[model samples]
Target: MLALNWHRPLMLLAVAMAILTLAAIGGMTIDDRTLTGLPIWTKAVKFALSVVIYSVTWAWLIAQFTRWHRIAWWAGTVAAAGLGLELTVIVIQIVRGTTSHFNFTTPLNSALWETMGLSIIVVWLATLVASLVLLRNPTSDPARNAAIRYGAGLSLVGAALGLLMVLPTQSQRDTGSAVRGAHTVGLPDGGPGLPILGWSTSGGDLRIPHFIGMHAAQLLPFVVIALELSARRIAATRPVAVRTALVKTAAAVYTAVLIVLTWQALRGQSLMHPDRLTLSAAGLVAAAATGAVIIIVRRRPPVDPATIQPTRTAPGAIR
Candidate 1:
């Protein structure tokens, strides 16, 4: 029998991220074609994204745990509670006529919803603690250990940002207070323009939410990729091959994605659009930063490539 090793967890993370990346593609497939129940594309994206996200999450939790009996039990309990609570609130809000589910009309609407969105926050927090526990290595958790630190830190940052979208902040109170019924808040008849996110077009607005959500797509994914790259072996056996791969991957793949994202940002009929500058430039910067980090991490590695080899065969061996 093959022994278990580092590649196991690494492969798990890579697969989960790959799936989430595909889900993002599915999300982009969503168009304004105007079908109900989530533009089909959005639903696909959401479903896939949700699964991939939770997979990384639970996997991490499982990995971090040296002992899983009770932890697993509690984790399952928290997840159940979250799902149940979230559903109940949405049902209540639906029955009460708060929202039509078009632009976040459910009780789970907005950032603050994380706090009350069916205990999603609590469940996510539980999952987080578990992942951290799984990855903890007291003897090897130094700055030199960028992969672990990057993985744990970036995941936390991404989750925090996500929850930030869920738990709405008080600063976005352009309409009546949140205490006011949903009827009071709606998209403007003019619909400011195609927003990156949020429901500015409706009676209410979700600019912050959209902005926050969109950024996470770039931020967390890249950060995780960075960790994975940092964790890669850089031995004489793979140095030239890996380094070449790093440069090509960063310079090409991201270069293309950034171009598309930038073009989308700047292709407006007129540069006078309010968000044109921010979208084109800021989006570029964020993409560049993420790309740069990935390249740097790929190039930078304190771990010996020889050390990263699998001592035991994993179920999902590369070859």
Candidate 2:
């Protein structure tokens, strides 16, 4: 197990999120109010949980930097503060019994929404700065290095996807409603959705790809860790070169999947009801990833038996 020099500010932010998560969970039990067809506290709980994961992952990631540590630390701190403010606005809106996002019904609501938008932009920019720093300083372990670099790049892409949700839909424009935008592409915001996630089941939901993309940073690192652990029993995965190749392959597939999900959402297709084209595209990506993994495993160098030492007989009994 490697020792991690965790960033204090980011870890504190994560702790705050954990506390908020518990508060939101408790609110859900007592509060019966609904927003956009779901429990009012649902958004709070989800955002809190997401922030906890994001903060913890970034805390660990920023801690790994030896060069440009100050720059990385500042970036992480800015990101933590921005995310904290964003979540704070969500909780405030929940208390106010109104939505926090894309809301322009009143001056106060519009200002709150604008604050969130600005905070998100700040967070994204801060993440970009840290990512550039990571790129400049690579770790010695090839697999871990690939995970950090690719994960940061993909996470930025995912965070950018949120911008799409701020654009007013055609209906909103035609109706001239105070509400400026929505999460659903083809339909209104309140509609049939998944259980806890509340992702649209009737229309396209941009949040799906956005959620997947943002977590890539954590997920990719987890992939490298899993491969490293498997190295104990799987000889083919033990080689640094092999593990690096596999990580690259996994990152490629992950990117392809994100693209597919984005394309599907843009087409106003529900995740629960994927069209043939979406299915085909997903299948193609899966096939490519499978083939790549097979080739990588097969190309592994054969272990030399000459290097294996023979077991010596105990004392003089066996001899």
Candidate 3:
């Protein structure tokens, strides 16, 4: 059984964020407005959900990679503190009825915003370090190893996206804005956006890749686990190898999709409108992924019935 004793504090923080998320949902009913033209509670809800997901995932991963117990402790502590401060500042701004990100009107507001930015960088670095540690000390199973490697690598991409968000964009340069760059492309920030996510459908939005890449930590492991469970049903000697190939193939496809979305966004194209380049990239990704899967499955070892577990339950079986 996977144990979470290594990062108990972060797990508890995740529970707290879950509670805050419910409260944010309730707050949404109040209809308070924010500078982003969205309800103030929307920020809270997003941050709360993100914190919950990240905290839980990190806790579970740290538990699994128990070799670096001390490193895990420091990483978890930094993550909890950094994320907690970020949410606190966001919620505080919400309460004050002001903007949180890129706000530089007043010195105090600018200071808070800068602090939030620093916190994000700190947390990102912590996550990167943790991922590197995991990569250095991987599990014996090939499929599981693939998950750790790809998940950590993709997550670094996600973290790097944040750094990009801070850089001044062409729009900001053209306008000579005092503050830093914004996340929205081809349109001003806080304009009409998609429901819930608020991603700009009118133009390129960087948040899409950030969201997808950030969740790779959860998604990659999930696929590997599902495949492992499925593999247990058969008695193939090369189950591990087969699953490893599939995992690599899946990671490749996932990276391709991320690159496509990012390229489209940079081009100021809407997610609904993919040009020839985007389509061609996606087609190639699909073809390559499919070919990899087919080759791995075809080359899988013969299933030996003798090694397969009996379907019938034993007398002392808990079931």
How much lDDT does candidate 2 score?
0.92
- The reply for model 3, stretches above 4 Å from the true place, is 1-4, 232-238, 301-319
Query: How well does model 3 score by local distance difference test?
Result: 0.81
Better of 2 and 3 by lDDT: 2
**Model 3 C-alpha lDDT per residue in residues 1-319, reported as the tens digit of each score:** 2334648778777878889899988888876565676777888898899889889878877777757767867888898889999999998988888888877768888899999999998998898878877876777888888987898789779768766567777877887776666777777778777877888878888888888888887899888988877776754424777888888888888888888888888887778777898889889888888887778888956678999997898899898
* Residue 286 in model 3: lDDT: 88
Residue 155 of model 1, lDDT score? 44
Q: Candidate 3 versus the native: TM-score?
A: 0.87
Q: After TM-score superposition, what is the CA distance of residue 114 in candidate 3 from its true location, in Å? A: 0.7
For each candidate in the order shown, give its overall lDDT on alpha carbons: 0.41, 0.92, 0.81
> Model 1: residues >4 Å from true position, as ranges?
1-52, 55-64, 67-73, 91-97, 100-115, 137-152, 162-237, 240-319
Best by TM-score: 2
For candidate 1, the lDDT comes to 0.41
**RMSD after CA superposition, every candidate:** 12.9, 4.9, 7.3
- Name the better of 1 and 2 by TM-score: 2
Q: For every model shown, what is its TM-score relative to the native structure?
A: 0.42, 0.92, 0.87
Worst 10 residues of 1 by lDDT: 180-189
Which structure among the candidates has the greatest lDDT?
2
- Let me know the TM-score candidate 2 reaches against the reference structure: 0.92
